[model samples]
Target chain A: MNKRTVLWTAIVLALLALLVLGCVFFGLFEKSVVAKDVDQPLSPEQMKTLAVRGAYVAVAADCYACHTAKGGAPWAGGLPFTTPFGTIYATNISPDKEHGIGNWTRAEFHRAVRDGVGKGDTHLYPAMPYASYRLMTAEDVDAVYAYLMSRPPMKVANKPNDLNFPFNIRRVLTFWNLVNLPADMPPLDAARLEIWNRGRYVVDALGHCGECHTPRNIMQGMKASEYLKGAVLEGVVAPDITKDGLARMGFDPVLLPAFMKSGISAQGAMTNQMFEVVHFSTQYMTGEDLAALSAYLFDLDKLPDKPASPTQPKPVAVAPELATAARGNYLALCSGCHGIEGQGIPHVVVPLSTNASLRLASARNLIHTVLNGIPGQHFPGLERMQPMPGFKDQLDDRQVADLANWLRAEWGGETPSAKAEDVAAIRRDE
Target chain B: MTIALKKLSLTVNGKAVDPVDVPDTMMMQDFLYEYLNLTGARMGCGQGICHACTVIVENDDGTLAEMRTCITGAHWFEGRKVRTIEGHAKRDASGAITQLSPVQQAFIEHFSFQCGYCTPGFVTGATVLLDELKRQPVARADLERAISEALDKHICRCTGYVRYYEAVRDVILNTPGLIKA
Candidate 1:
């Protein structure tokens, strides 16, 4: 070939090599700096405001529930998290220079908090919840960092995370990040109402309720199509708070903020992990924030439908023994609040006929709730809420079993009888 | 590998426990089951749904409340007093359980428990209910409602929840001045 043609071919190949190299570097971007640097020293007044704002943002995000170990110093970490993979302990987020994030620059901290990338370019496991945090605004991230930095740093080293096989490899998270998290926040809907926007920010960004409430795909990423429809969490049913689900449960949307804040309303009391979430997180939230959350959940009523399972299961047949026991119990003990026809008294008691928990396959929650009896007022309006009493003293295990089975059968729609042994097991286990 | 420790001191089942170092992550269930060897508070649903892990806590105002041991930390009970099922019986000089508490006796009479794992929590909860009822006696007409309200929160997969109410009612009816005349 002529000399000119040969040189042109070489140039084209060289350009191609540069392009491939650029893509590879971008793919491994976690190794390089990503956060924008903030080098200015703020005045005391500015620091105070920033710190205070950060505290609010932290509460909005419910950081303490995951970051702080029970009875441990706030943000000192060591909260044991059990995942399908293995146990991964939360890290110390206090401002200790040696053991915590004391030395982290704003840029570095931002990336870690927003992108799930830790110091030294390490990919943080999803347990840190950067996936949801990624939706946060830059200002919100900054305020949270400032608040966290203001905390007294206790020298607590993070326990090494115990994960199995390829999960232990931090690099695998890069792919998961690519599939689940977007690098930039979705464009704002300028036309949306202010409260709707605020609610969206809290539900989709700060609160990260979807992490547990939203059903997961095979890869453990959220199934966005079925957003807020409902999912199982830690062997307990996290009921669908979606507009339709809430409507089905007869939950008053207008009263939701109160319910979120206090764990009680005219409907019923919160139980299981919800009880814990209300106790640990929502209890500390501002009324406005809770209102925003309720707003978002209420607005979800108009979302487009997707292929999804029924929010609850259909009922099965009941055992004669359970039905007989339930009949007697219903007349004597339960009828006061629940009513003889299983029609619950309005504003005072939740109806068993349409309740969500009764239709579930496992009787553990039913047994657990019956044995424990509802106690404590996480919110103010709980005084107006109806009370459920424990029968552990007066009822035999067999009778309790029959009652649960009967409730499921009659009101719950043809449901299977709860075995006495199962009740006995739950009673024994918890 | 060493984690920070905290000092915990509390009265358990009427016995004062000296201050001891406990890991902050140590749950109340672990404290009762492992440290103090008070196994009555069984861990059912570690997340606080099942009241099987419940223990009776006395407030400063002399009111009693029930708490879940599985989710609560041992340190949360520091400087507080609590009672478990193991404490529900009067002991002789030889440390033998001589006489069962009224709640326990009623539970026995009603056959309230099956596996008995959740019995301690129930017993504590019922004991608290009885105390509250004693402080403010309810009208005879309100007796069923009050008893249902007190016991509905405690779960029993056995006995269909009827007998427990019957037993508590029996106690109230038999005990003079428990219900308004």
Candidate 2:
């Protein structure tokens, strides 16, 4: 231990302390707009009223979709959400004191919903969609808190997340929040109608539609650039719902709201996660709320009811490859249910000619659906679609690709050519 | 325009139905019941969902597969060998029924059907399963699953499905070369 050695050690230690302090100081500059106000004690009547309002708010928020596992107890929360990092199980938000948020104060709940900060100041992962929920008003948070607390508690324990190292650390999420979570939603455009503004709030804030619909950046945060242009989630492409995207799909604004209410219409039937969306959330929305949602989603600047051009479709050119074997395949396996010309039997099969999935440029959804056929679905009314059995084992990848290509050309009209590799890829993902 | 007619020929129940001009739009079920008078495959759902209208079509590769007749056009089965419920049993020159096929006998023994509307379809399905197993036998442990997969598509709406499944299982178990060596 010479004087020079001791001097070097002191200098290194001082620099390391400075670096540590600087990192902590920088984290404080994350510009958090955390809501600290808990709801004041309410009268019994006020609490009841708030809880009732909160019930609708909870549906608008669609908490049930993520929280409830298939056939699992409602609000008990054991649904597993898979991500590139790992799988994260949704937490129990029921009134169970031991397992859920029963003991959580209103202030703590507000922070969790609005600020992405949980009990004990631990940062919640973005899977909670608190970034989108950040737009919710303080009163909305308190109302949700009231509603959740009123639910019957279950003793079901929360499943531990299966994230890899570094992601498993809660401290890492604080930094993730610093980079990802915005301070607040942008100010409402003054030019938009009041109804449109209301709709935007329902979609972006309360509904948190962007969480699944928007594309994610390298950090896996929702990209601010691609707001609602659509992205693939849970093996199915969550189709674009942007105004232009909706228009491209021939969405009548008037009909979309009705579709949202019923989850089935001539345009399309909600399946996959969208089915869960309607079952747990959107179906319960009021007519006015749905109208606003449609207005915002469609971004109708002009009159919504623009009639289409009355023109007949020109015949699509079919390739010899598609015409011979693929056409035979369709007639043998598919034509029985879906008519000879893909003009699906009414109340039996959906028309492939006008199917929204076939119209998409990407063959992912169409290929996936063909490989993994839809289950029997019943809407709010007498309308029911029969279960289409999967043809994964019956049809080879080339056959699936050729069939898709032929169908797209004849019915969907010049969509991308689906390849055998795409079918193979989708098969692997599933 | 006049009703278009097309020449059609196919082997049905070991008898080659000659190239008779039947309407191209006619479904196999309609052709079978109206023209041939075989009348075994009954129309149930018309939507092809109810396998009551199923017929066994022999593939070019000699493999057998069940196909719905209610929705498929008659031309789809043209130039192919098809077997209906009537073809399964043995008969004498006088057309008197002599011996029932193993599937039919098993169904009778298990009481697998009541209304018998779906019996043809179930028999067709089980027959295909038997043919498939003969070609490539499954392990005895997987026989139940094979039977279930083979016959589950046919809706009986009677006899709670356990009897049909039991009957299929009994046929597979009793028969040789069905269980893997």
Candidate 3:
């Protein structure tokens, strides 16, 4: 009786081990991402059509902005992305046989983009925004691949990432995927309008706006609840694009795409890092798709209550000495381009009264922008904003602090608390 | 709309002008043309993109900076010293031009200005470059680049940049101690 019982127990343990190994191999019955057919060599006409479609898809996905380094060949990939951990340089994706994805099979490429897994099952860092890209259809991603592969092959080597310890470990990213990547794109809300559903997909899958706009959790994964609520990057806040956030910035659904296409409006000019977005992605998007994006941002994110107008901050009283000095300084320095009343000149300067930079809780962006003047941007059309001269050379830290204090207190309803030391710290680039 | 007014006083052409109330928003270019009757600093692009309206502001550090008067209010120069194009030449007691400055002479000899509208900014910019060179000389190889950078912000509709640039180059080559060995 004892021998039979031991043999049965051994048999059960063997079956359990096999089941575990099978699950590991099959990834829990998940379909093989690359098993489907790769397109055969296309005819001249087919290649032309595919390439054109792929170019559009690439623009929609914003592949050019992140992949290409400044002044580097398009898609040659040396752009460095700074994170809390360290700087992660983009990989060369050109069809260069030695240094790029020329050797990768369609399956490998699809799996890398769709699942954030590189060749040999290596986990890729979230810097690639695969969590969002996974929502993209295989056809769209493959179209981008085809277009990128057709581009001139650049032998540019991918720079090694300068990430800090623990983050340098690639295996750590698997946990990031587990927590961040949704199991499946949430089932389409049938109850919503068709355009609304399309807009949701446009924003989440193609745009991936949340990657930068959403605040990251402790793990550095985007906090889904705060989707597009805005987060600060490179010193400036990527202002909230949530329904109410957009409203406060004076953008309704209809005006959203217009602002995007034009890059300048009464609200603010998109000539900052946002210029890069409009330059590559949204500018080329179809009007319908842009409308879809706006629809999703403004309507899908509607608040349950308090759709009231963004309450203006009551002007806080500044110290008489500081107020007088700052007002005079503003008249002499800033009033020329930005109107005497902060009304701003059209076709040249954005109105300071409605600017999002002045209304932020921290004056980091305001200080940075004032210290480092924004270069006048030229859009695709006859659109341009005249450059605002930085007064850093003309004014000292005390003066900048005072100006910031005045801008905040007068316009932002914030108290005058910007100290000379704060401006000095930011000026020192701390 | 009634314009705000501010009392402005500044040293123009090395003379301390009497304090006078001006429209708070009056640009320095307008102040030069309207208040002082010194109209040599022409306003090319009132938005300040073109440097034809540049005026020299002597900083506290003794470094001369070319500030655009088209976008800078007259009040900006309060308690500060400034020089317009008229300040460059030696004037007689009768207010007649007696001696042209080296930069002005170089421009005339090179025939740098056909319309003569942009000549003032060129003079101001070249003077600023000369002032900068006097303080800290540039390497001989860097002299051309320095000159190019100094006048790069200006525009000439007549397209006479080559002659003007060459004239500035001749001045740098002819001047002493401005070029490092």
Candidate 4:
């Protein structure tokens, strides 16, 4: 062979070897850093205490429902959650030294659980529910950590999250944390009773009930101003638990605890997602806790009444066909629950005549409820009152749109029209 | 396949039974139904999400605690004692098991069940909660929480949650020194 050919081949081999060595070195260095930052060993006694605490925390956190792979080990996480953006998988949290957080230090664990930061400073997607966990006390976090470490180790590697380009950029979460996240505990109201304060802490902090119950801004960050004023999540409408007489099922503060504990209100029983929350979390809370949650929730200032007249009531002359059909449908189906005069069953059904929530808000709830009937309880004493039934199977998307538009126009006075497209979107939710 | 089983002796409902060998993976609910014929704990969601299969596990201390039988394996009860709802009603001086526990009475009085499916779990759970709170009195608000938390595992679809709350509240209020009526 020629000397030139041999020299060129030798150079190529050396370059390839150098590249392979560099890749291996980089991988080892990354893992070592992560291990050094995250892993911390626990004593056996601490493990036992943590196990007990973990059980309670697991219940409190409702972690199993989200983390456990369908029919998998309790905390050996692999649950897939789908969102509008993409699907996210819950990582293995079991005490598996190799696959899970078995190697994570207490501080690293705390950061991941509370602050949503991972080892090597990887940003966890907000889907981790750290926004609510941020409210957890240090001790609570420790107890949960203890429980996780105490569990029998399961070797389950976590699946990668499937978020789109911009969202997959984990570094952007650093900014998301700064602007949207409230990393600190809520300031305690000194004037409130200890029990009431505890309730506030649990609800606002540990329970993070508002994360689901409260409305959100355009960026999906919770709207603090409209906290617990009800929001639509996944597909379920978390009703306004606030004591806006018209918005809530006319539930007074006194009755709110009963509602929380039992998932029933004066007007109707809770169904769907709210039912599960109550069954798992609120129902397990101490009565004082329930009362405190109710007390704090009831005290929020009622939403300011909208002016009777809109400054610019955009006149979308309702299409001739839609107007007639919507009016006819409302009279036939709604008047039974909501009286012909639009004054609903007092305290039993929300009055439509002057209902601010029905009039001014987004038509997502109206469309969804009309399409999918509300599942409710029939507790012993109140067997007669069943929850609202879904009309999805019965009504076309356009019909639901027309009915919702009619309710808003007639009751709320002047609001943006609910297009057929809105109904279609809500129907596709599940 | 000849399965190897472990012999375990434990008191159930205050009655001592002969030790029996059973598979480790068998659920507590199946064990209770097959061996003891104590079928009060109904299986609703086999998954731990619903508490229909709750039974009171008598701790080493005198206190009783609730655990779901469906999800928990029978092997966990190797040396543990348990009290089902069937065991809750006691025999009075008359030598007949005529007296229902306060929780049971309260449930009956308040009409807590509609389909009567989740009642046993609620009853068993409430009994344990009441027993724990007996030593230290709970406030009215605390009573509600105690009851709700106790019965939190159980799911009832019929007769909205109000009646169940009322049933537990009645038991707490009626029990003197626990909570003021």
Best DockQ among the predictions, by candidate number: 3
| lDDT value, residue A192 of candidate 1 | 71
Instruction: Report the error of model 3 at residue A158, Å.
Output: 3.7
lDDT of 3 by residue, B1-181 (tens): 9987778998998899999999987888899999999889998878788788888998888999898898888888999999889898999999899999999999999989899888899999999999899888999899889988889888888855999999998988889978887
Better of 1 and 3 by lDDT: 3
Q: Per-residue lDDT of A1-430 in model 1, one digit per residue for the tens?
A: 9999999999999999877655543555343223444445445676678898888888878888878898888898999999889999988899999989988877778778788777777788888878888888878887888898899998889889999998998767876776777556667667776667788888888988888878888888888898887787765557677877675555555667777887764346677667767777787788777777776787842222232333333555665665655665554455545654555765456666666566554566677777766654334444333457676754678888888877776655535657778777667753
lDDT of candidate 4 over A339-366, digit per residue (tens): 5556666334545555443543567766
Q: Which segments of model 4 are wrong by more than 4 Å?
A: A1-43, A50-54, A217-219, A235-237, A243-248, A300-363, A374-390, A401-430, B1-181
Against the native complex, each candidate's DockQ, computed on alpha carbons, is: 0.02, 0.40, 0.55, 0.01
- Candidate 4: what lDDT? 0.69
- What local lDDT does model 4 show for residue B129? 76
- Using DockQ as the measure, name the better of candidate 2 and candidate 4: 2
Mind giving the per-residue lDDT tens digits that candidate 4 earns over B1-181? 5554656567888877678887544677888999888888998866445678888888786777677777566655656788887888878766478889888888888888888999888888778778877866777776667777767656789987788889888777777877644
- Which parts of model 2 are misplaced by more than 4 Å? A1-31, A39-45, A301-316, A324-326, B1-28, B31-37, B57-64, B72-81, B92-96, B129-149, B176-181
lDDT of 1 by residue, B118-175 (tens): 6777788778888898889889999999988877767777667777788788888888
For candidate 1, what is the TM-score? 0.58
Model 2 per-residue lDDT tens digits across residues B1-181: 4656777899998899999898766788889998899899989998877899988888879999888898777877779999998999999999999999999999999988998989999999999999999999999889888888887778888788999999999998899999997
The residue-by-residue lDDT of candidate 3 on A8-91, one tens digit each, is: 999999999988656644445433334356534445565456777899988988988988999987788899988889999988
For residues A122-166, could you state the per-residue lDDT of candidate 2 as single tens digits? 778788999999998777777888888889998889999999988
| Candidate 1, superposed: residue stretches over 4 Å from native | A1-45, A300-322, A329-430, B1-181
